[model samples]
Target chain A: MKCNRTDIDTETRLELEGALDALTAPEIRPIFDKVVTDGRKRVTVDIHKVTMIDSSGIGAIVSLFKRIKAEGGQVLVIGARDQPLAVFKLLKLDRVFGL
Target chain B: MNAETKPSDAGEPTVTHVTFRLRASLAHRSLAIGLVSTLVEHVKSADRDFRNAITTAFGEAFNNVVIHGYRNRTDGMLDVEAELGSDHMTLRLIDDGVQADLSSVTPPDLSTLPEGGLGIFMIHALVDEVVYDSGTRNVLSLTKRT
Candidate 1:
C-alpha cells in the first residue's frame, strides 16, 4: 500500500492506494499513527484508490480511530470505493467513522 | 497453479479443481487471493458485487488456514481447490495443519468496533453456505449462489 500525505491547514489528509488487507494493513498502521499523533488534531483518510480490504484492514483503521480519539483528535475517512467500501459498510464502520 | 474447465450435464461451464498452495506468509496469502480473484473474475466478471464477496470470503478462509491452521509453518503443504458452476461457486480448502474447532465461530459484536475476530464473521455473512470438516483433514467448503 502507498499513502500520499498532505497537510491541508489543520487536517492531515492521507490518500491511500492499493489493498488494505492483513498484508498491507501492518505497513500502514505506523504511518497512520504518526499522522495522527504528530500534533495533528484533525485527520482525513481518503481511500478512493484502495482496491481491496478485509477484517485486518478494518482493525488497523479502528485502532487509528481509537488512538486519535483518545488524544482528543478528530478523524474523518472519505472516498472509499469498490471492495473496500463494501467491507466498511458490512461492518458498519462507515457509519461509525461517518465516512 | 493447476485448473480445469469443463461443461457439466447442465451445460454450464464448470471450472473444476483449481488448486493452489497456501504458504505461511502474508505475501503468499496475497498471491493466493490474487489467483482466486482472477479465477472468480473469469466466471463472474460482469457482476462486481458477487466477485468481491467471493474474493473476500475466500481470502479470509485462506488466511485462517495459514495463521490458525498451520501456525505460520512454511514447511507444510496446504492446498485449496475451487469449482465454479453456473449458478453457484464452491471452494474446497484442504490443509494438513491442526484441525479447527468452529463451533464457537460467530461474528463479533460490531458495535464494539473490534480490531480482530471479524474474519470468520465476514465469511459467514458473504457466503451462502459454509461447512468446515475437522475429520482427518481440515476442509473448508464454501458456496455462494447467485
Candidate 2:
C-alpha cells in the first residue's frame, strides 16, 4: 500500500492506494500516528485508489477517526468504491464516515 | 490448483470444484483472495456485486484464519476448496491452527463505530450461509446464492 500525506492550512489529506489489508496496514501506522499526534483539525482520507480493504484496513481508519474525533477534530473519507465501499456499507460505516 | 467438473442430470447445473493450498500468513492473503476472485469471474463474470461480495467475504475469512486462528503465526498452511455452480458458490477453508469459537462471534454495533470485530460480521452478512466445524482440522464453509 502507498500512503501520501499533504497539509493544506489545517486540513490533512491522506491519499491511499493499493490493497489496504493486514499486510499493508502496519506499513502505514506511522501516518496514522502522526495524524493523531499532530491533532489536525480536518483530515480527509482518499481511498479511491485502494483496490481492496479488509477489517484490518478499516480498523486503521476507524482508530484514526476515533482519536481525531476524541480531540474535537473532524475527518472526512472520500473516494471509496468497489470492495472497499461494500465493506464500508456492510459495517454501516458509510454513514458514520460520511462516505 | 486442481479443478474438476461434475456431470449433472438433464436439467441440473454442472458444478466445478477447485482446491488449492497456501501458507497461512498475511503475505499470501491477497494471492488466496485473488484466486477466488478469478473463480468468481469465471462463474459470474458480469456481476460486479457478486464478485465483490465473494472476494470480500473470502478475504475476511482468510484474514480470520491467519490472525485469530493462527495467532499471527506464519508456519501453518490453509487449504481452500471452492464449489462453483450456475447460480451459487461455496468456499470451504480448512486449517489446523487454533479453532475459532464460532458461537462467541456477534455483529458489532455500528452505532459504536467499532472496528476490530467487523471481520466475522462481514463474512456472515455478505454470504447466504456460514457453517463452521472444528475437528481434526477447522473447516469454514461460506455459501452464496443468487
Candidate 3:
C-alpha cells in the first residue's frame, strides 16, 4: 500500500492506494504515529484507491482512531467502497466512523 | 492448471476444483486472494456481496497461516485448493507450519473497538463453516454458501 499525507491547517489527510493487508499495513504505522505525535486534531483517511483490505489494515486504522480519540481528536474515514466497505460494515466500524 | 470439472446429473450444479501452491508470506497474499476472487467471480458472476465475502474470508485465512502458522517465515509453502459449485464455494489452505490453537480464539467485543482479534472473528462471520485440522501439515477449510 502507498500512503501519502497532506496537511492543511490542523487537519491531516492520508491517501492510501493499493491493497492494505498484513504486509502493507505496517508501512503506514510510521505515518499514523506522526499524525499522533504531531498532535493533529483532525485526520482524514482516504481509501478510494485501495482495492482490498484485511483485518490488519482495519487494525491500523482502529489503532489510529483510538489514539486520536483518546486525545480529543477526530479521525474521518472516507471513500470506503466494495470489499473494504463490506469489511467496515461487518466490523460495525462504519457506524463508529460514520463512513 | 490443476483444474477439474465433474459432470453433473440433471438439476444438479457442476463442481469445479482447482489447486495451486504459493509461497507462505505476506507478499504472496494478494496472489492467493486473487485466485479465489477470480474463481468466485466466475462461479457467482453477478453477486458482488458473495464475491466480497469469499475474497475477504480467504484473505484472512491466508494471513493467519502466514503470520501465525508460518511465523512470518518465507521458507514455508502453502497449498490452496478451491472448490466451486452452484450454491457454495470451499477453499482449503494447507501449510507446513506450526498448528494454530483454534480453541484460544475468541471474538472481540465490537463495542470496545478492539483492533487485533477481528481477523478470526470476521472469517467466522463471513463464511458458513470453518474447519482446521493439524498433523503433519495444517489445513484450514473455509466454506461459504450462497
Candidate 4:
C-alpha cells in the first residue's frame, strides 16, 4: 500500500491506495507519526483509493486515532467502502468517529 | 466414484476436482442482495435464518476481503473456498496481493470516531470465528452454523 499526503488548510489529508492489509500497514505508520508530530489537531484520512483492508490495517488506524486524541486532537475518516464501513458500524465506531 | 484414479498414462487424463471461483465488484448499496444471493446459491438452501446468518457473517468478511484484503484492488480476485456442510459452512479466503500482519492488526478504540481499523472488529463481531494466517500465502478462514 502507498500513502500520499496533502495539506488542505487546517486538515492534513492522507490518501491511501492499494491494499492496507497487515503487511502494508507499517508502511503508513511513519506518515501518521509525522502528521502527529507536526502538531496538527485535526486529521482526515481519505480512503477513496484504498481497496482492501484487514484486521492489521484497522489496528494501525486505531493506533493513529488514539495517539492523536491523546493530545486533545480530533480525527475524521472519509470515503470508506463496503467492508470497512460495515466494520466501523458494527463496532459502534460510526457513532464514536462520526464517519 | 472411483477412490483411486491414479492410472498414470498420457491419455488416461488426470482429473482435478473443480473448485468454483466467482469474482465481482459489489457496491455498498447492494450489500444485502449480493451477499444473500451469492451465499445462498453457493450453499444451496433457502433457510431464512441460515441465509440471514451467512449473509451477516460473510457480508462482513467479504467486505474486509475486498476493501482491506485486496485493498479494493478494482482488479483483484476474491478467492473463496466454500465447503458446504450439513451443520456448518466453512469459507477460506486466499488473496495473493494483500498480506495481513495478523499480530499487529487490532480493533479500533470503541470510544472514539476512529478514522480507521474496524474491519477485523466487525468480522470478529458478526462471525462465529475468524482466523488469519499469513506467510507466502495470506489466508482468512471464517465459519458459521446453519
Q: Highest TM-score: give the candidate number.
A: 2
Per-residue alpha-carbon lDDT of model 2 for B67-87, expressed as tens digits?
A: 889995769899999999888
**What TM-score does candidate 1 reach?**
0.90
Calculate the i-RMS of every candidate, to one decimal place: 0.9, 0.8, 0.5, 7.7
**By lDDT: ranked, best first:** 2, 3, 1, 4
lDDT of 4 by residue, B33-125 (tens): 253445454444436545544555555466665566666477766566655544555666666667765433466566754555554555566
Ranking by TM-score: 2, 3, 1, 4
Write candidate 4's Cα lDDT for A1-98 as tens digits: 78888988878888898767545777888899899999888898888677555555677777888888899898888888665665556666565566
TM-score of predicted chain B versus true chain B for each candidate = 0.85, 0.93, 0.91, 0.60
Candidate ranking (DockQ, best to worst)? 3, 2, 1, 4
Candidate 3 residue pairs in clash (backbone atoms < 3 Å):
none
Candidate with better lDDT, 1 vs 3: 3
Off by over 4 Å in 4: B1-81, B84-88, B92-109, B112-124, B128-141
Model 3 score (lDDT): 0.89
Task: Using DockQ as the measure, name the better of candidate 2 and candidate 3.
Answer: 3
Docking level of model 1: medium
| lDDT per residue as tens, model 1, A33-94 | 78766878888888889888888888888988888888898778899878988899989988
How close to the true structure is residue A40 of candidate 1, measured as C-alpha lDDT? Answer: 85
lDDT of 3 by residue, A1-99 (tens): 799999999899999999988989999889999999999989999999999999999999999999999999999999999999999999999988889
